[model samples]
Target: MSDLPLDQVRTLLAVVDEQSFDRAAAVLHVTPSAVSQRVKALEQRLGRVLILRTKPVRLTGSGQVVVRFARQLTRLEEDTRAELGLVGAAEPVTLPIAVNADSLATWFLPALAAVPAVGSAPAVAFDLHSEDQDHTATLLREGLVMAAVTSAPNPVQGCTSARLGRMRYRAVASPAFVARWLTDRPLPEALPAAPAVLFGRKDELQDRFLRGLTRRGATGVRHFVPSSESFVDAVAAGLGWGMVPELQHRADELVDLAPDHPADVPLYWQQWKLDSPALATVAAAVVAAAATALRQ
Candidate 1:
């Protein structure tokens, strides 16, 4: 296909972001029919059905590609404007990134704060979306974020991937929990029946640990605490045994259930291979901080 028209591509992005044609029109200060027409023209040019027209407007594979291109074009335009002194003094660049909850709770924010300013504005304003390390790349793939702290080492299409080291997790439980559920029984026998704390339904750390010892999944009551800090708090409050990040694990309150079976989830930094100064600065800060905060 010929070069995608910037106006139509941007209009499609607006619809994706707003989740509706009417909202996109309001944002772009155009009629809803105009928005629809632009999107339709773009789709016709590409010979692809870009949108599913669902309630929230789901994008097709072709749509995702176009949206990613639109976002990159916007990023490049902003960078060019900033370099040429065309940008307003009050507007700082906003960089959107995907990060896992554990890293966000521990080392991620500090890294962002340490990023040096491109000029007068404080580094760049941040828009963070936190998800599991295993799933953060999904946001990157969907054109939702520019960079991600993900478990996958493979690059996503136009992105570069760099190793950021591992976040080690140790199986741990409160003294009371151990006393009540695991005092006399063998760990293999008691653990399968004992209550357990999990970060989310997708969390497999605790279950993975159990599988190593018992050759089965945890069959007991499961408590889901999604936040990293709160997951640790839930375990400390005797909610159940869980896998706590080594950085967040407290020696006094929680005892390691198995020192030999630590779950080491290696994290990687993934970002679009862009030449923008703001993105490069943030990437440097994140890599440097990860070197100190994460296990090498």
Candidate 2:
């Protein structure tokens, strides 16, 4: 442990986050060999392998622990500088947060913009990790972000959570597509027959909504568009029908398949329990914006 150097620990974290020794080296302005050597030395000292050398490399269980410590160390250093006024011209606090694509397209940006700029405190720059609401909390657990808007009510370790609001989604299609494919048949029967657009394989929201409405699951044919904006556009372009976030749907003239049965996914903001002024300000702004934009 005494033999382990902080530089080596930080280098390991950089590689894990950047997912490439070459990229980490570039960030550190060092040769890739240097980065590799540092990591290797750290592994030898710790007597535990830190990372899996794979594409978009993954951290080992022990690696996650070290990554968490590295993040904490970085935070502490920043806080100390701020307290000591060592950092000239209060630097903008960069808040890294995990959020779902639906929220990102809808209310999240406006909420971030609403955070008041403090004296010399740089404007908040958000580092957003876009993923499904149900899975956003996993980023927090891995110490990938300082905050998250997730579907999970239970907070991650060392984090606090508060309900943001619920995002309502409706199964929708273009008028032409509905007329051609649905033709007044019961949705469950017609949905399986019509082409559909899914956010991704993990997206069960549309399928779950269909099951509740028609007592059956989604169809086999689905065009995977991973992005929230593109998924809506795919439906609009008559490529396939999908569940569109109500917030995004408000401006569009898309035909709602089942007006009475919209899916409501509750969202929550979870952040580290640290009392950093920057984190607090951002949280307040996000909560305030969510209250107005999302359905309670």
Candidate 3:
């Protein structure tokens, strides 16, 4: 394939970020017509529609690919400049990463803090996007993040994956909740109708546990607590039972409903395949932290 024009690709990314050709032009110090022309020329060259010019512009599938290429190009450019001492020493490189809420609440930030600057490498800043581990890879696939902590072992396209470890979760409820709801019958019979706390609409751990036990899903009122800390607080305050991660579990406030069974979610680190030192340093720190924080 022929080479992609750097100016055109960068212009497409600018429009996507700014959401309007006029806004992009303002940022690029060019006319709106020039921005529009660049994007049109890119589309014509690729023989595909790159964008949908909506109120807020939207990227087509091909547009997403080009934007990803543009970001990677930018990353490489910054790395090269930093290595060559062309970038200002005071400026730190910012890496956008996607991580699940649980890991962020527990061990993720510490890992970032522990990352040591490689010889003469620029300092780094993190722009973290918190999502469910099951869905974090979507950010990587959409080019929203350079790296992600995900549950999927398979890598996203243009990325490489490594096994991080397992996050162990136990079915837990407050003693008050158990006395009020679980005393009626065997767990299998009582749990189906009992109130339960969910992390979010995307969370399936509680349902998965229920299905494994009773061959059915929870039928009672579902309480949605989206934040990791609040999810534990909700469960502890007798709002509902939930699958609580081992690191976040409190023996004083929460009781293990199923002491014998636990849900172990396998976590993976996924990042772009580029040989970037900043990315490598962060990835290594994360892997080291997970080694101690998660189940082997």
As for candidate 3, its clashing pairs are: none
Q: Give the best candidate by lDDT.
A: 3
User: RMSD of each candidate?
Assistant: 1.9, 2.3, 2.1
Q: Write candidate 2's Cα lDDT for 1-296 as tens digits.
A: 43459999899889977889999999999999999999999888888998889999888878877887787776667766767776555475567899999999889988887776533343556788999999999988887888999999999988999999899998899988888899887767888767889998889897788779888776557899998888888889989888999888833658998899889999999998886767878888889899999998
Q: Cα lDDT of all candidates, in order?
A: 0.90, 0.84, 0.90
lDDT of 3 by residue, 1-296 (tens): 23999999999888876779999999999999999999999899999998999998888888888888888888888888888887785777778899999999999989998886434457887889999999999888877789999999999999999999999999999999999999989999999899999999999989888888889889999999999999999999999899999999999999999888899999999999987888888998999999999999
Give the lDDT of residue 41 in candidate 2: 90
Give the local distance difference test score of model 3: 0.90
Model 1 scores a TM of 0.93
Q: Residue by residue across 1-296, what tens digits does model 1's lDDT show?
A: 23779899999989988889999999999999999999999999989999889999988988988888888888888888888877775777788899999999999999988886333433377889989899999989988789999999999999999999999999899999999998888888888899999989888778778888789888899999999989999999999999999999999999898888788999999999998888888898899999999999
Give per-model TM-scores.
0.93, 0.92, 0.92
Ranking by lDDT: 3, 1, 2
